[model samples]
Target: MKNSTCLQPSLATTVALPVIYSFLFPAGLFGNILAAWIFSKQAPTKRTQYVYLSNLVTANLLICSTMPLLATYFARGHQWTYQSVVCRIANNFGTLIMHVSMYVTIVILCSIALSQYATLKKNSDAKHSPAANENFHRCVLNKFRQPEFAKYLCIVIWLTVFCITVAAIIRNNILANAVGEFHTCYSISIEAGKFTSMLAASLATACFFVSFMTVLLSYYCLNRHLSKIQKNTCIGEKHLIYGTVKRNILVIQIILTVCFLPYNIFSPFFYVLLPGNDCKKSNYLVEIKNFLNCLAAAKSSLDPVIYLLLDKTFKRSLYGLFTKSIPEHHKGKADIFTEETPDI
Candidate 1:
């Protein structure tokens, strides 16, 4: 976003953003490195979740890596003093990391939801058919049960995000108009046309809702199925499974709400609320957007803590590292969403 006099961030916001980014940089760097190391210890091919989680850790690291440049930008009175190319790279990378991390987290939630759905289906089939080993059920069970599937999914996601990000970078740089002595990189300037603003707003709205709806649907389906299972049969591991699913749902809910929801909801408006159209409104919206983006960036710093809290293996490893105690050697497949097999 361009630094226009018509929509300058408040003095407080300028100072606050740098301070927040500075804190996030070191904290996110250390935490994500630890997370990546722990995730890498498990072979991704062996545990499909390890692939998604490993990519998520890397994505967060990328987000964190952009903090220094951002902190500099903010500290320099919210202006870009660097080369245009460097500024573009830093700006584009920050957005890219955010989108990639969000989609990867969505994929993780999908993986968990699909696994639970398959189990529910298999149970339903078992009740109906005396022969629980039916081919149909087996096929359904194995649908998304492959590590290769997850790898391919991640590859596709990365490629798509790369294309979208590159397009955004090109559009922003091409459309930018200098507001003053300092050239603004992505100006919704009076000189620039409305095409870029329209395109960006449309894209932002679509991306936000798609991811939001997916998470909501996944949570709803899992909760409904779990409720049915509990009512039908209160068996061993029932409470444990319910507890795990609920925790996963709540964590994802909080992460998305904090990181993506507010930024996405208001970003389109920020783009369209141009300086020429309404100076006061534009300035207010710009500051609000800046604050929301800062909150979104904080997700990178928070994700490692989320993993430590939610993933048993990660928690144990972290504990052992701090306490200087020998950690238990985990055996077999690490289940991310099951208490029985504790790993992420």
Candidate 2:
């Protein structure tokens, strides 16, 4: 019932996103690019965690690459037509890509948590071995634990997310076409697409919660095991190993909580919960939503800090980048990944 003028952008709304995102764009680009380069320098071993971590870097890179477009959209999206080709491209590349990165990062972090737990579980078991009844163990997410299989699964994840995102983009463009072009790209007429948008948001919210729980559960079990060891004696090698592993899991959980939680919690409100007819309420809510989304998109830059904290090889590789003094530089590639290096 309200006119489009009701939710007109405030100067804060206009300036905030572009400023925040412009800064995020360069920082994210440099961080992710640095991460990818460091990963590439690692010895060629199909370690399962490496696979997930590399894909995470790739996902983060995808998000950061779109920051400029997203920044521009926040500043000027209302002036564009959703049905235009350029608008559609921006919607997909800038907005849709952010969601894709979000979900991809979530799923992969879940994979990492579960995979690490499985590794820790098997290692703690005295009877567990390479040939110890893999048939029974295969049922326990073992398929994802294998490096070769992990590559295939990561590919499937990318494809599945792309398919879903593209479908949403197509549906929006079609609806925008039908609704007539004057609606402005930013105001996608809540009354027209409320059902579909809310349904999608509900599904995505459910998925996010599932990933959140998975990370929490993994952290609990891992920390519990480590707690037992540390209580006995914190000086041992086992205590140190499990401690680092638990810290890594904790960092992942923190990233999910800080970066994505607010967005997921508030996003579903834009359709069904919020009264779009109320101008003041709608305007403030829209700004909040955009700011929350900016936070979600910020994980791309934060992941490199996690890598530094959790990955010894990556840390050493980063050190390698600056220093020419490689330890045993003459040692062949085969000797690089020695038995002395515990693959934790």
Best by lDDT: 2
lDDT of candidate 1 at residue 171, scale 0 to 100? 67
**Pairs in steric clash, model 1:** none
Q: Once model 1 is optimally superposed onto the true structure by TM-score, how far is the C-alpha of residue 320 displaced, in angstroms? A: 3.2
* Candidate 1 runs further than 4 Å off: 1-4, 42-45, 77-86, 93-142, 177-182, 185-194, 197-201, 275-277, 322-344
Q: Evaluate all candidate structures by whole-model CA lDDT and list the values in order.
A: 0.62, 0.70
My TM-score estimates for the predictions, one after another, are 0.80, 0.86
The stretch of ten residues in a row with the least summed lDDT in candidate 2 is: 332-341
lDDT of 2 by residue, 186-223 (tens): 65352224444566567778878999998998888767
User: Over the stretch 15-133, how does candidate 1's per-residue lDDT look in tens digits?
Assistant: 88789999999999999998888777633446655666777777788778878877765555336532466555655666566556655555555555555445444554455442545
Query: RMSDs, each prediction?
Result: 4.8, 4.2
Q: Which residue pairs collide, candidate 2?
A: none
Name the candidate that leads on TM-score.
2
List ranges where model 2 is wrong by over 4 Å.
1-4, 83-86, 127-138, 188-194, 227-235, 327-344
Give the distance in Å from residue 33's predicted Cα in candidate 1 to where it truly belongs: 0.2
